[model samples]
Target chain A: MPIETTDIARLAQILENSGVDTIEIEEPGLTLKLVVDTRPRIAASASPAAATAPAADHFVTAKADVAGHFRAAHPWQDKPFVAPGQRIEAGAMLGLVKIGLLYAPVVAPTAGIVDAVIAENGAMVGYGTPIVRILPHAPSNPLN
Target chain B: MIEILSVTGPASIQDLGRFDQYRFGVGTSGAMDDVALRAGNILLGNDENAAAVEIPMMPFRVRFDRNIAFALTGAAVAAEIAGRAIPPWWRSYARAGDILNIKAMSHGARSYLAVSGGIDVPMVLGSRSTQFRGEFGGLHGRPLRVGDILPCAASTAAIGELGIEPAGITLARPNAAADETIVRVIVAGEYDAFDATAQDLFWSSSWTITPQSNRYGYRLQGPAVKPKEPVEKRSHGIVPGVIQMPPNGQPIIQMRDAQTSGGYPKIATVIGADLWRVGQARLGGKLRFEQTAYSDALAAEDEMSAYLDRLRANMRLVEETRTCR
Candidate 1:
């Protein structure tokens, strides 16, 4: 049977009640992804949302949201979109994942300075593969 | 709705050309890159004949006055909104107050911008394409200029941003010379008038697109092709893709905005399937004509149809994935 809207609502409620930050259910053509964001922002495109988790000192790694061949620069462009040490704003594009003719952008999840580009150019990447490493802008308080 | 903030290059609203008005002495004025325009409309779930902004030159910028889902296809331009560069052949939702600036194009000659709801324009003669000669259709029947505010049909459908592989890249013929644009053609009514040597020269010599080329027609420069005797012909009905040779022996391929009738002798007609290729050929570029049979032209049309069919199916699949969540 196909999953109903009420079923999805119930699953979301359960996840919220259990204090789960995120829950993804992938079954054939269906995918139920719910992320509890701490801040308000436009999140993802048609591609799957990247696994954005903060590491040491608010450092976050941006990963590929879709599976494709990683392209540092667009096919028509000569220079890569992002460079190490370059300050990036949230939602900024770091690279592209070219799947056939479709180019799925690898976007920055948080405002930060580029530390390194993890995935090599032209490398075949799957969903959640790290593409760029960033040291996120330090929170003014660092504590709740 | 969006406000045209700037237009550094020529742009105008167009749909599929007006076909019914040719008998009334009106020419068809449609997207030069109809394939891109059609695919873009399909991506936005808009009508196939929905009007879009055809931008041939770049550095075009616009500001969204309201939230709208839009698609950009054709040349691979660096189109950025809110600092996010969307690829060509892509659709995305633009928030009110967001600005989309299309910088230099890197690939094809023209680009099309199709919004969620097609650009709202008064249709003249059953089409929204700009009739430049008649000055009747499309926003005042002229090229788009800066500070023009165009309304869009109201729509509220949820849109998922995506892109499609352009048919120009996938369905291209592989046998053509690497540097020259090739368009398939069939011998026309005046084919028999030309001598064998002249006919051979017409097919073998490379033709360069002159600077005078526009929506009216593409003026080609090549070796003079003349018939054995000067044949005067009465002006008769013509359509886009008719390659007519004038008294000077230079060929002119009529385009979307070509006149309904001309007295020029026709040497060949570009097949409908490959007309888009000729339309996208850049000025100052070279083009070669390849002879094709009627059956092969139909097969080419079928291939184009299949390409569009697959694109529609892919869009449906994307919609399904979005709703399944």
Candidate 2:
């Protein structure tokens, strides 16, 4: 039997009510994906290349040099080592990775403002896994 | 030197332990987590067996009377110096009058604070450990109290390095989400006396640590293990790691401060290497036991010694790197 339009509408309704961002269903002859439109209007206002150009130029990712579990801060510390928008000096520790019985600190390459934290705390990360994004501090151009 | 500003829970000065004193009816009183004490001392360039403060209960606050380098290890507890957070198991320098506060444990049960030259208390019976039962050793033989003044020996080693990581080591109690901690036991002393079913239950059933557990012993709650017959055993020499079964049938694993002798029948003894696991186990934690061969126990000890050796080498390398920088 062919699928009914009402069935598809009911599945979409279930996905919306469940609060999931996306859901996929596969049948013998049909595959359906329902995704909620969650992007804000401001992001849609800019052209794709123009929107990405600034990020590519200003943001630099701090990656783990060693493979291990990433920690935003020491286990005993309640606050993260660096927070988004916080100004950090060169050589400042941005995060830590615990590889066995040793902790390797991820230090900032240069003085910068933390743009975003990419790796989740306590998540296992491999070598070169981006942990944080930083925007080099330029006195003339402050992040708004 | 350091001064105890306030202590919320039981805290004591401990070294490796008082050895060769068991014959004198004295139990070896030492840091419950000896591995942590050793690690902390190593980080500070002190003797591996140097006396350090073992803070089992938390919210402990103290002030350095003079500049000193210290390391905190073992339990992952929130620690701060003058309101600045410090990493667990890392050694750092503190200025005079800097208040160091250790909050409740976030993971694990005991924490060790080792100064560069160790806590300078009069050694009693060839040891600086606290004998709580006699109340004679370690800072007047009692747990640290508010307003107590603790003397710290002048440190001779240079420890200017910062951000030293404990690196891939964790000694905290296994969290609830993880599988039950498997403690390897060497079946001994009357193990054959238990009925087959009881023996099976002893090995298979998971045990929960009761709230009554302390430095002396961990009272476990699990299926009762009954002997094949009503057997009475005479009181004999007992040491840490002996799992005894009393009338209630629940097993009680003796610990650092356990009595020198007990009348209960001993079913098994936790190997020397894994005792730290039991030491770090918190109340309400779950654990199971697996019968381990004597050869395996010895091998485990060898492995533990190797790990310690590696830690020492790594820390020395860190110190050397700092000096070069």
Candidate 3:
């Protein structure tokens, strides 16, 4: 039997609530991985004007909050936090900037598909530097 | 073999130490965390006293000039090779041109990087350790600089034969309390010269490692331990871990680079097994001394030797198993 879409949604919800970033489950003939980005982003309430801007409908640039070396993934992780063309939800983590012992996470402002990764891994980035570009997700039909 | 890329602060080549050189007025300057040095060496199948890089300051970077197996121990620092993370007290193989970056220490104060067959610096006084005061041994007897290329002893071990895993050996103090370290000390012959009140305060009070502390000695800040009366004496021979009470009444524990002789009265001596604790103690860290009998000190040394023996046996077994496969 194949896993249903509702089951994947539930797994994603569970992963988000558990405070873990990723989970993998393997059965006899199926394997599923659920990853939830928990990094904090610029609050939607404070950026209402920017969210409504005309450019927001298509491309949105995610900016860093601190000056440090940018890393697309944790040092031990093999894959980038958010890969290009990956569909990501609002508030999902995009990447990280490490300053000394502290790490600041970059998060998505709205649900979107990643268009490009602007900041190179291991490159030093300054505050408000654009790190990633995203294309806003199109609205789904209510009847569907 | 590795080439130094950038160094944040002082780093030196060290082994166990230059032994039997005290009569010539030569101090035994070696790795601050000797336990870490031994661990790194053993993990890489090098001689236990082989020369390795003692990194006191962090953000040290080096590029592997050739494929080799290496081990890192001590100071729980964040380490990476070509951007892939590796845990402390673990061994891994690196390809040529892979940059190994060691970040600031998270827990301890120093780290040791040991490669297979050890660093091949010429020895002086029968040791490869840097005598910083004399400026005679180990990479021109100075800290490593950017673009310095140090030779590594030749090894025939295959890179595929090395395993990546924790060596299951630890030299850290067991069950130590948070933010405070308990170091074991054996009271010296002149310990009784102090007043009863001062003696009581010595064991009861916590001492802070002052910023003045270095590889020479740990200048501690705590309650002063005054002798019963002023007494003059000639200078006598001393070694690392000797707790000397100078005229200032503050206790100074001589370290690896300390002078061979001292005129101050010795109150206590830290046992060899517990000296690593003092070495890993960060500046401004808290330390409390606990008096132990002479026999207990001997037992601690035996325990340390036995732990190393077990680690060596395990490493050999792993190597043999990998070769058979």
Candidate 4:
């Protein structure tokens, strides 16, 4: 399913709120990943601005912040994510990966249509590997 | 044109560095004193990443064939123009027949000298940084030597005042200590490879920079932290701040010349913004490991970039102010 792209900082904020540690995507060749809050946590405010301030959202995803090959969710599986017609919800499992010594899990960003699956499953994913495109539902504002 | 003088302690052409070349086995090699490099560039109205001379300790001398505007930053070195005293960390106007000289570093190990316009050197691959092992990039891929002349691009001489204006620069110099020692580190890699006790010793303990310290890495002398598991993984790309421990159990903080890959387990990595502190470490330097969160690292990097921008802006203001005056 297509998942809306969120900046790393925003993803960091999301992870912080959810208290999640590891994010893994395994599509065999497309095994990408990101380990959040790995280093000792420096004291910082959970400011929304800090969450959305990275230069490029694609590269700083919850997966492989460092530069490297883009990977798929599962090498032996059929596809990495839903195609243009697939549907995904917020907090849904996206994929998985086998890093140095751990199995990481990838998840969906929001409820949306799978507009596209950008990367080939099981393909090597680098930092900011884009797996699926999500058409997010517009957020409702009660205050407005 | 820049003239070649005595190749002081260690001077070479440098720029920001190379990136995204990990798969190709390329290491990121660039200016050791990043803040100084930016400051020097701003003083000369040159691009922050423009190639310049990075002097680490010792004194160097050079004769110029023409007039030029240059600035010194990072360490406090006794500099001269044609044997006449000049200020450190500030811009100086040199004449065609003048010679430039640098004395010992009063504080930090590395100092940067940026000329107006910047260094006019051919780019190697994608940078002007010198990679000694590759035997390519920056002035024939070697340290500056006697009788070597470098081409300089023309640039403005002042960017306002150093302290009064905004310049996107971050001074990463270590704090002065009565004893020459300080090692700051953040835990990373396979920390569990070592027993719990070793991990404790690694963080709580202090280490001394061994005499073997050089451009490649710092051989640390301290309590041993051996890994519990025998690591046999293939050697992969490493970075300047990576602390790789061989079976000997001693730690080696890799530097600019570190190998592209290593099989030994990594215990920690120095944060990006603080990498220069590792760069400025001299022989016998003392070090203490401090754990900083990933968020802190990101914030530090972002802040450092901002400082560099401010420093650049300040430099431009200083130059414009000078010209108007």
- Model 3 lDDT tens row, B1-325: 7899989767899999998788999999888888778878877778889999988888999998787888888677788877756655657778878999998787778888899899999989989998888888889998899999989987435443222222122344675676788899999968889988999999998999999888889999988888998646688899999999987788999999899989898999999988887888888898899999999999988877776776677667656766797
How high is each candidate's TM-score? 0.82, 0.76, 0.68, 0.63
Which runs in model 1 stand beyond 4 Å of their true positions?
Answer: A1-58, A83-85, A98-101, A120-124, A140-144, B155-160, B175-179
Off by over 4 Å in 2: A1-80, A87-93, A97-101, A104-113, A116-144, B155-158, B161-179, B323-325
The alpha-carbon interface RMSD of model 1 comes to: 2.8
The docking category that best describes candidate 1 is acceptable
Q: How does candidate 1 fare on TM-score?
A: 0.82
lDDT by residue for model 2 (B1-325), tens: 8899878768999999998889988999898988888888877878998999998878999999788899888878888877766677777778888999997787778888899889999999989999888898899999999999888998444454344344224322243334366788999788888988999999988999999998889999998898888669888999999999887789999999999998888999999988987888888888789789999999988877877787788777766766897
- Summarize candidate 4's per-residue lDDT along A1-144 as a digit string, tens digits: 333355444445445434567776566456546577656444644445556655333221234322223344333233553457666666444554333212234456676556666655544544455656666554572212
Candidate closest to the true structure, highest DockQ? 1
Q: Judge candidate 2 at residue B308 and give its lDDT.
A: 78
**Per-model CA lDDT versus the true structure:** 0.84, 0.81, 0.80, 0.66
Docking class of 3: incorrect
Better of 1 and 3 by lDDT: 1
How many residue pairs clash in model 2? Answer: 8
Residue B288's lDDT in candidate 2: 89
Off by over 4 Å in 4: A1-144, B155-184, B319-325
**Cα error, candidate 3, residue A74 (Å):** 16
lDDT of 4 by residue, B119-214 (tens): 888988788888877878889998888888888875343332122121211333345354443444678778878898988888877788898876
Best by TM-score: 1
Q: Which ten residues in a row have the lowest lDDT in candidate 3 chain B?
A: B160-169
lDDT of 1 by residue, A15-62 (tens): 443345687878998887887653435554544444443244467989
Poorest lDDT segment (10 consecutive residues) of candidate 4 chain A: A59-68
